[model samples]
Target: MELSRRGFMKAAGAGVAATSLGAMGFGGAEAAVIAHVRPMKLASTTETRNTCTYCSVACGIIMYSKGDVRKGERAELVHVEGDADHPTNLGTLCPKGAALKDFVRAETRLRQPMHRRPGSDRFEPISWDAALDRIARLMKDDRDANFLASNADGVPVNRWATTGMLAASATTNETAWATFKVAKTLGIVGFDNQARV
Candidate 1:
C-alpha cells in the first residue's frame, strides 16, 4: 500500500488528466466538439520583418498582422516576436523590445503635434503645418541670435550653440548620414543620436 514519490506523482498526474479530460467532455459523443475548436489567433496572420527601435542593437522582429486589406479592412498588428534568423539578436529581445507591442497600442501615444505656449500649464493639439512653421521660426530666431561667426581668437568657425539635434536610432544608415550632413551644414555641433544616449 506504500507509494514512492515517483509512484505518487504518476498517480496524481493521471488523476489530474482524468479530471481535465472529463471536464473537457472528451467521451465518444463529445470528441467531435473538441475537434471543432478554432485554431490559434496568429496562425493565419501575415508576418512582416522589422527591427526594434528602442536602441542601436536593432534586434530583428517578426510582426504579425491580421485582416484582409483588399476588403476595406486595414491590417492590424496582432503579435510580435524576435526573429530567429537574424544574426544580431538570434531570437532574443530585451525587455523594451519585448514590450514594443504595448508601446504601439498605448492609449497615451501622441497622434499629432502638441504645443504648450510659454507660461501655459496645458498643451493643445496643433496642426502639422503650424507645428513645423513654429519650429522653423524658433530655430531661425535662435540661430540668428546666438550664431557665433568667430571665436575670441578670431577663428572663423560658424556655429549655432542654442539648438541641438538628436536623431532616432531606428533610422536607416543612409537617412542617418543625410541627417548628419544637414546638421553639420547648419553648424549644429551638439548633434547626437538616440543610440548613443
Candidate 2:
C-alpha cells in the first residue's frame, strides 16, 4: 500500500484510462474481474466465548467451530481468536494463546492421562479412574510417611512436606478457592499455581 509519488501518478493515470474505457462501454472484462467476494470460512462457523488458559491473565477468547453436536454430530474446532469486547486482554493474545490451535492439533498432544511403570521404556495411556486412584494412593502413602505432627521445639504442627499440589491457572475464582481449601485441609505446604509461576 506504500505508493511513491511516481507510483501514485502511474496508478492515477491507469485509473483514469480504465474509467474512460468503462464509460465507452468496454466494461465487461472489468465486471468479470471484480466479481463479488464469497463469504469466508468464518462466516460459516459458530462462535463461542471462552477464556485463554495459558496463564492467569484470563484473557477472553472467541472459539470458532464447525459442526453441531446437538443431533449426534461431532463438533470440530476450526479457529480461535481474542475477544475484542473482553476487558482483560482487549483482543490481544500471548504467543501461547495465539498458537492454541497448534496445541489442539498437535500430533503429540495428550488427550488422556499417561502412565509409565518403573523400568518401562514406553508410556501407555490409562483411564482417568486408574490415574486418580494411583495418584491418591501415592499421595496418601507419602503423607503418612512424611507428615510432621510437631517440630523439634514440640510446638504442634500439622504439615505434609513430601508432596506438592499445583492448581491449573484457568480455573474460576470459586474453583481456585476450593482448591486452596482442599490443599490446606490436606496439610500440603508446597501448594502453588501455574499462573503464579
- Look at candidate 2 and give me any clashing residue pairs: none
Model 2, runs deviating above 4 Å: 1-40, 152-154
Angstrom error of the Cα, residue 15, model 1: value is: 39
Report RMSD for candidate 1: 9.1
| lDDT of model 1, residue 71 | 87
Candidate 2 lands at a TM-score of 0.72
Q: TM-scores, in order shown?
A: 0.69, 0.72
The sequence of per-residue lDDT tens digits that candidate 1 reaches over residues 1-197 is: 99999999999999999888877786665777768888988899988899897888778999898887878888887788999998889989999999988888889999899999999999999999999999999899999999999999999899987899998887567988999999988898899989889
Scanning candidate 2 in windows of ten residues, the lowest lDDT window is 30-39
Q: Assess candidate 1 and give its lDDT.
A: 0.89
lDDT against the true structure, each candidate: 0.89, 0.89
State the lDDT at 41 in candidate 1.
80
* Cα lDDT tens digits for candidate 2, 74-163: 777889999999988899999999988777778988889999999999999999999999999999899999999899999979999889
Candidate 1 clash pair list: none
